[model samples]
Target chain A: MDPANRPLSPHLQIYRPQITSVLSIVHRISGAGLGLGSLVLAYWLISVAAGPEPFDFAQHLVGSPGGILLLIGWTFGLLFHFCNGIRHLFWDAGYGYELSTTYVSGWVVIVVSVALTVGIWLSVLIAKGTP
Target chain B: MSGRTSLRRVRDLGTARDGVHHWWVQRLTAVALVPLSIWFVTSIILLAGSDHARVTAWISNPIVAVFLMLTLIAMFYHLKLGLQVVIEDYIHAKPTKVACLLLNNFGNTVLALSCIFSVLKVAV
Candidate 1:
């Protein structure tokens, strides 16, 4: 039997998308998003150190509507990855393996991430006196 | 030991020997990021709309500089580890996989250095 010709496992279409599976995939996606987002963050930091002109330019770009949208999306990605990562830590510790607990923890991660994102944004807007 | 031939032993034991170390470091970085990220996000929000001088001054604080440096290092390294796993899992072609992994490592190091350098510029 040729190793290169071996049949692969079942494709994603074969399995129903459960919360556990969906969250699992989203974790990886969010992690990747954060990876890219880190570059943006680094650029911002570098610009700040460079001086007012570059800092203002970077600020202007991020303050724009599209940039704000991307920032918001990245915020969600950060929170999701953060929350789900804690869940993963629990699993790493050999807990949360039961079927019911797994589903509960998945939902908990989603809810907590959403709540935290909203809370942070609300506070930010309020602090800016625009909320 | 079971009576396995030398060829069998060599075949079974592939080239990967440090996978557990990778996993451990990934987890260690993750735990470190939890606190660092909280501080980072809160600081960013608070510093929003502030002038460059104010932001620079904030980063100049000794505690702030130390935390920022730590965050930058951990965040980029974690990002590299996470992306490496992602690329390894999804990329099937051998040549492409090696290329992506190399790029991942190199790109992360550059980004990390750039950020850390920026921090030091302000802090010092």
Candidate 2:
């Protein structure tokens, strides 16, 4: 096959953005983010098992400003991936394939993810008596 | 005559026929993760600010320990599958893609094993 004669598909630069496409991309990104974030989870569990000294150190690190930011990002990542994964499951089940329904579900995933994340953090704050 | 080339016929019979298996397993793991993740997040939130002994005591519960193990396995397996797809899509180089895929598998296994081990240590 001649290189010059090879067929090329439309690239991202030339493709129009749509909600479904954007959500699909974000789902992949958030999945990757959560994969890395699992390390933090592992660290917390391991530290706890090690002893109180390490557990307190881990807690302090997690409660620090930088750690808080990382946790926030991970929280959103987890929630977004979870919501979108459910949407994908619906698609797999042969539902929500219509263009309108796809768009609606995409928005629903975004809204639900944000609401859940905020709700979780709000409860945490209330429980801590810091709100 | 069939409207197919000889090369196409042979190519269709190639060895890498496991795509469906991967897809199915990924979906299965994703479904398993739904409840496990909810359980995990809620447990963490409820345990927040609790002392080490308290947290360990929670983990020591057989029910909690079992769920924790399930979560670790399902989460990492799903994660590996997701990252495998990402790597396969973006990494065009053959050697690099294969290397990344291997690393993803091994790395996730190590991470999951260490997590499950910790949980068991605390629980047991």
Candidate 3:
């Protein structure tokens, strides 16, 4: 049999989206976002090491409205990836393979990640308000 | 570094023997990040809107610096592994795929080093 001529597996576009499929793709999307977010984190640290001027520049960048929006987005991505990564870990441990369980856990990941993101942002808002 | 195409290499070798090692390390880093990232997020929340001196002081603490570096390392390692899988799964052209793979490795290493160095410079 010619390997080149072998039929390719169906791609993602062919499938009707389900909770399982949707969350699986999101896990990848959020991961990519966090990878970009890490760059911001790296710059924040580098600016600090560079001294006050650079640090202030970075702080201003992050504290600006656009920067704050980006941070909020990254916050949700971080929490979503964090929660969903735990789900992957559990599956790695040879547990939670049942279809019903996967669905339930998928919902749990979504809800928990959203809640955490909101909580963290609210804390940041409250913190800013106080001092 | 071999000249063989990725499809050819993958088909002939089956699992390539190191697949499990990659999977294992990915999981290890994920586990480490679980606590490390939580500590980081919580600390960031606590330090939100803090002044330069306050933020630097937090990073200057030896304990905080240690954890920060640890988190940076684990996060980048895990990210590299995850992105590798994504690229392999989606990118079909051999040269483009290989280029992306190299970028994934080198990019993660550079970022990780920069962040680690920043932590050390402030802490020490």
Candidate 4:
């Protein structure tokens, strides 16, 4: 094959958005978010290890408005990635190939993930009177 | 240049035949992370309002420490693999791509090790 003249795959912008395609892109996006968010996890763990003052500072930071929003975003990203990842595992196992099943599963992933995210936040809010 | 064929020139540059290993490991880590992430998210949520002493004591538990370390390893490995794919997909420039890939690798290793060490320090 000629390297310079090789045909390119359709660029993302060229295609109309569909459930499968949208979710596919979301998987990558959320994966990237969670990957970066792992640093926050590291920060929390290290703060706890560092002891009370640092831990209190960490808590205060996390409790702040910006930090809370970021945490919510990460929470959704984690849940979406988790649910969609299971869908991917099913596809890898040679299931969920039919178009109808793919669409259904895609919606299911979204609804379930959102529900779980809301559930988690509500639980947090009710327990602590804040999120 | 005189005697070597075009195929010979592009041989190793094309496929390294190591993609399957990368793909397989990504899936393996994904599987491992399913339970690990669930355990972690749920634990953090439950620990939400707890003070520093409670949280530290929780991490210091033998079982909790082991799980935390495992979670860190699998989570970092999965993140590294995923980021490598994203970088390869979008970053076309060779030098920048190489630099990002290297940073992805070394940075992930440092992050994972430090997190693990933190857990150990607290647990002990």
Candidate 5:
């Protein structure tokens, strides 16, 4: 047993929450979620190439209840990941180094991601004549 | 340059000692995604009511195929790095954290392979 391996530091719960920390966590969460969700995309692409029966099956899946939930979740994940990724880019650019800017961007990511998700679903509703 | 430094710049960041590799990659992917993602979304939109041949032909273009692969690959790689950090930060149990990290990488690899193969199969 090595000394370096012994006695680790306390985990995230111990740290007081902040905008940077929250977004950092959500960024990864949404990223992983979206990454997993890409399976649906792969299936759709392959089915598209395989022709109509396969494509129809894929469409049915997307139209199904569970599928719709997953689709909605994936959409939200994509929106959040995209928004947070942009905020991170600004941080990388060193423009949001200021704490106030950091907090503002964090809230912006949350609000905008939600907005984009609803806006998308709204369009879908309108297209379906359900709105 | 001195043997040590302070207030590290973006290009200089990495996992080691306040570095910026993750930061840079995230930014690079963000910039790359702007056009690539738009292209992707638009393709999907155009794909609405698209026939099988249309979808196949669209992706078969070498440029589109290459760029699409790049987009997915970058996305998964970026995701792996992001989740690795998340695991490191959040998981308190050493073995559990390591296991999760391994799972994360493995999952990404499998997904990437499936997606890439599916695209290539269509193209070829």
Candidate 6:
């Protein structure tokens, strides 16, 4: 088979940026991010089950500055993955077929994820009475 | 009048029927994940300050135990399907795709088994 002779779909590079495009890329990126993030969760579990010393060490790690950064990244990763998963679900259900609806949903995922992350942080602060 | 021959105009099967099956399963798994994942996340946060006994007891409860098992199965099952799609799209070679797909299942299964064991150990 002559591969060079095969017809090709229009290249994505030529298309102008669009919300759908961002959403499409982010969906995959966040999925990969969250996949890696699962390891942190597993580590946490092992620590918890191992006993006091391990648990305390795990806590300190999670509580340390570097750990906080990872936590923040993981939180956003989870939120982004969840939001995009919902968006994909909508598409699966046959909603958001129109370009406008697609864009709207894309923006909604972004906004909702931010709101959720903020809401979680707010709840944490309220619990600690720190913010 | 004799019936005329039915001429069915054939258009290209856009996106193919297999896609619908794939899309449907992905959505089904996604929907299944909603409540389970909420419980999973909230449980983790709640367990944040919980001691070993507290965590173990919570996990040991029959309802949580069963759902935790289901959660493991559903999560890895869902992950397998999602990763398979990525492999199919990005990796062109038939052998490579098959290898990746098989490796994905193997890795996910192993991961899921370990997590499930952890949960069961806590419960027991």
Ranking by DockQ: 1, 2, 3, 4, 5, 6
Model 6 C-alpha lDDT per residue in residues B1-124, reported as the tens digit of each score: 2112233114424444356566666677788888898888777656654556676678779899889888778777777777888888899999988999889888887777777777777777
Q: What C-alpha lDDT, on a 0 to 100 scale, does residue A87 get in candidate 3?
A: 94
* CAPRI category for model 4: medium
Every candidate's lDDT: 0.90, 0.89, 0.90, 0.92, 0.76, 0.74
The interface RMSD values of the models, given in order, are: 0.7, 0.8, 0.9, 0.7, 2.6, 2.2
lDDT of 3 by residue, B1-124 (tens): 2334577566865455567668888888999999999999989888877778998899999999999999999999999999999999999999999999999999999999999998899889
Query: Which stretches in model 3 have alpha-carbon errors above 4 Å?
Result: A1-10, B1-14
Which parts of model 5 are misplaced by more than 4 Å? Answer: A1-21, A49-51, A128-131, B1-23, B49-51, B92-95
Q: What is the alpha-carbon lDDT of model 6 when measured against the actual structure?
A: 0.74
Q: Model 4 TM-score?
A: 0.91
Ranking by TM-score: 2, 1, 4, 3, 6, 5
The better candidate by TM-score, 2 or 6, is 2
Interface RMSD of 3: 0.9
Write the residue-wise lDDT of candidate 5 on A1-131 in tens digits: 79988987877778888778878877777777876677778778667767778988887777777887887798888888888787777765678888888888889989998997888777775665431
Which one wins by TM-score: 3 or 4? 4
Mind giving the per-residue lDDT tens digits that candidate 1 earns over A1-131? Answer: 89999988987999889999999999999999888888899899999989999999999988877887888899999999999999999999999999999999999999999999889878877778641
Q: Against the true structure, what is each candidate's TM-score?
A: 0.91, 0.91, 0.89, 0.91, 0.75, 0.80
Candidate 2: TM-score, chain B only: 0.86
lDDT score at residue A28, model 3, on the 0-100 scale: 95
**Can you write out model 2's per-residue Cα lDDT over B22-55, one digit (the tens) per residue?**
7888999999999999989888888877888899
Q: How far does residue B25 in candidate 1 sit from its true spot (Å)?
A: 0.3
Worst 10 residues of 3 chain B by lDDT: B1-10
Pull out the clashing pairs in model 5.
B13-B19, B13-B20, B13-B21, B14-B19, B14-B20
Off by over 4 Å in 2: A1-7, A129-131, B1-15
TM-score of 3: 0.89
Q: Which ten contiguous residues of candidate 1 chain B have the minimum total lDDT? A: B1-10
